[model samples]
Target: MFKAYRFVFIAIIACFALTQCTSVPKRTQTPQERPDVQQQTLDLEDAKSSADWLEEAWQAPNDIAKNSALVQAALTLQDEKEWQKSAAILARLDKNQLTNDANRYFRLAKGRWYAHNQQWPQVYKTLEGLPEQFTQKEYKRLTLELLAFAAGERHQYWQALAWQVEAQRYSDEPSPNALWQTASQVTQSQLPAERPRDLVLAGWWRLIDNHHQAMTSPSAFSALLDNWQNSFPNHPARERVNSWVSSDSQSNEVDKSTNTIIAVLLPLSGQYEAQGLAVRDGIIAKVSETKSYELVFIDTHQLSFEEQQSKLEELKPAGVIGPLLKGSVTEWVRQTSLNTPQVFLNQIDADTSEATANSHSIFFALNPETEAEQASEFMSSASSRTKRPLVLAANTPGSQRMVERYKESWSGINEPSVSLFSQRDDMKSAVEASLGLVGSKERIRAVKIAAGKIIVDEQERSRRDISGIYLPGNLQQVRLLKPFIDVSISPFAERIPVYGTSSAHELTNQLGDNDLNGLIFSETPWLVQNGGQNVLLNQWLDARSGWELSQARLAAMGYDSVDLLQRLPIMQRMPGTHWKGLSGVLSVENQVVNRQLQWAAFKNGSITVLEEQPNAGKNNR
Candidate 1:
């Protein structure tokens, strides 16, 4: 489990140890300015609250004592759950005054603060190097745990499992369950194809991977555990596997039903009928791959709200997935008695506090904002040295949402320059204005006007301040926007990076996508798998030549919805666990399922999946 840093204990050790260190140079403070060292050491023992430590820092004899006191004050604030207050104190501390050990404590405190705020990149930057640096086992253990949690949060499951394996050496008891949880989340593709160098980690990974296949068949899990223990008799996990099997058996005995009925509601014959069918088709596709389920589909458009309620009462399904329309979903959830582990296709307008509190239902929507936030996260961690960004969006609700989300998630100091175009005709003009092309043209015109007959050899120049451009538009819009951006960049300026949403990419002929070359975008793994060499997806596309990418995405949503139905309970119980779904890497927070999508870029007029970059923003900071 992830726990807050017990800085109070470490802070006290760091405080007293500060006076004995001779590694750092002594501060050149006047003799009159310094407090009595013997008195200050005695006063430090009585310091308890943040204010008491701050008072001690103010009265400290020199820079070393002062920094130690300040560091303790910050740690004290963090231990009290006042992270922001602690951050303010940490910001002002002079690390130069502290010994190597004291500086390690300072870095740990800052990393803990960043972890509390869910700032993963900052956490990675602050603590990625401190694991081996710590002399104390407790501090090193916490650092490894933080790194593991951060890696898992970012969907770096293989890295997370490695951290878990390392953390085990410091713990008194083995955390086989925790290691298994992180291991199970690692997709087959993500796991190293060959055995890893670490035999312990490799053995555990192989065991858990086999365990996944065994879980499908009744009584197979126990047999698999026995076989694994026999094979890796001296493995670290061998000791913990027995208890795990016993715990699983006791739980399985209480609830062993496999034939649970699930109710699905979609619009079969209305304005949104096509969208509803795509989702249903996706569900059927997944069901076809797995065990046969009694999937009862209800067309919300055809049935009245009260009739839908009466039907649910009579059927009493184990779970429900649907009511695709926003209005229908909102009305459906208002009925308190109809609660049965539900997954609404559209988000409810009314507050879902009551429904999600008890883990009865979750709202899953394929919103443009979610993809935009993912784009923002990807760009933030991208290897680009872009400090300033320019966001060019269409003047639509979805486009606006993208812009808003990009700005909200952005980590840089400079605010993104956002420009919106309402019409297709304005796309070129909007891109030009945002890039300062219009201003460049005006400047040349003014120079010509000023010098009547003189020949001006000056070329138009775009702004140099924009390090990157984020454009979240549809295929056609992106096609036009990319070309506009390509041509608009000043000859004098460096090639600025451009990022877009999944909507920006669609199944199009390579010749038609020449303009999108070098443009990076966020997309679902299902559509962009195997460098767009998705055999089944291509076959489906060839079979249905007229299907739009939006329909395909809805189908993906349907497929992942079926997955969510199976995994939501586990996610609800264990908040930070992730499932690699067809749509994206899914994790639940506040009963809302969020997707961390895969990334791709256009190169030589073809889509290519981008490799996941580790420590992406290490140098950027």
Candidate 2:
């Protein structure tokens, strides 16, 4: 009986040992057995929950030193499109230790991030770095898909189509087919009816059609029109499409004929009649001789807003211009729906939102912002020649606007030392202060006595050191500031330069034969001796009967404006090309005009053109 009890006790001990060895926790597995144990645990946990598997794997002790847990987590985040997090995880993997699968997955995640950011260049960079062995059909498929998307974003429609076509070799997906269809719509003249929903495609089609009409490419345009008609046989937009095609065809033919109506809308008998007539003359002179266009003039004189509207409605002109008074412009814009392009001859009260809104359909002849930019470039060049600049103006609206523009223009270049002087009772003191002589006791004493003559003379002597002066006041006001000018010019009149605007023409009359002898500035054509003789100038002059004076710059502006419409397709690309006229050299791009003003120095009681600067195209001009 004792022997039998011993055998049973031995068997029980064996059973306990077997249970402990077989059911041991994965964490406690022997070093050699750890991988197997962990694998078993991973299988069981994966069967239950991937989330639980990740949690347990992350919690595994250092004995389980593989990066499997981190990699799995990364894959999870990447599957959810959480690209940044996935990239962070894959970055931690030692490249030499990375398996083929891990490398492929890592590249896939990075490519996706780049594609999301529309970084086409970076996408290509990443794809190029993948291992040669990773070039599986799946990788090619994904690469092509992303390549197509990036190409489209970059406006490379042809490349986009090629990529989509290549992608089709690997995947039978409808998305790639749709992308190809859309690309074709953009790059090809003909398009299928069942194209994918793409707003860009529609915009491209419209742009191409408009361009074809503008360039008089009838064959290309007709083919596109026919294709569109056939594609949308029963489409609701058929009427609008037909109308555009027909109108464009007729307009193109008419544009070539002498019967082309060029309408002029100016204030013939209003307060600003003189200025209006100048602009009118400028337009008529150009077209009257050119058989290509017929000139039509409409005077907005003694007409109420409603009457102006009625007249415009009755006279369906091909194009219109002017109505110089700000109030008159507001009324005309409100009443006229001629669908004709109109040009505003002068600056309007920008405070009027309605007039500005009208600019969408009509072109503004001069944009203050554009003017300021040009002025800045001009000032920058001038500033380089003269290190010191003085801005002189009154507290009037025109003066204030000019001052602001001057400041903006000067800000872009090496800023010149600036001093502002007011045209008030304290003008003398302000002038001295601007010259940096007011605070000096000796300088003050010199100008304080002898009818303030000594100081004026001394200040004038010191003022000659200044490089240039920007005078924003009218000629009358400028003459009033002559004493101040004398302070700067008395000693160095030939060396010290003065600059003024079109207003300076009035001041020019006030100056002695040599008073403004060294001054250089801009003026309207009417203010100058050679007011009206260029072929371009005659166009504007002939528009109106009277020789009402205009800013000399107007002639150049008119030519640039008309020339832009004539060369719209290449406008953006033709920046540096010079458009010479009475005003000066003009640089135009994308319908934006930048004037390269010729430097005219006052010499021997007359203005002489000095140097002609190169127009910097769209840059500085």
Question: Which one is best on lDDT?
Answer: 1
Q: Give the TM-score of candidate 2.
A: 0.50
Per-model TM-score, in order, reads 0.67, 0.50
Runs in model 2 lying further than 4 Å from the true structure: 1-259, 334-337, 347-360, 364-373, 382-388, 412-425, 441-467, 480-483, 489-495, 506-513, 524-597, 613-621
Model 1 collision count: 0
C-alpha lDDT score of every prediction, in listed order:
0.73, 0.50
**Alpha-carbon shift of residue 156 in model 1 (angstroms):** 9.3
Candidate 2, residues 1-621, lDDT tens digits: the string is 445434433543454345444421122102211111111111112332335434544454531223455555554554455445555555555645656665665565566656554456666666653423445565566666666665555556555655555565666443523542434334223323333454334433443344334334323655666677766555434565576578656655643443356556677676766655555545654565445666666777766667766766666555555555666665665655555556544444444345444432333344434443454546555454324467666766666677777776563333444444544675666666766554554755645774553325333335433545666666667666665666644443344456655555542342223566656656433334342233444454455445423433454454334443343322222232344444444444333344444445456776665456423122341
Give the per-residue Cα lDDT of candidate 2 at 486.
62
- Candidate 1 stretches with Cα past 4 Å from truth are 1-45, 48-258, 383-386, 445-454, 506-512, 530-535, 538-546, 612-621
Q: Report the lDDT of model 2 for residue 23.
A: 28
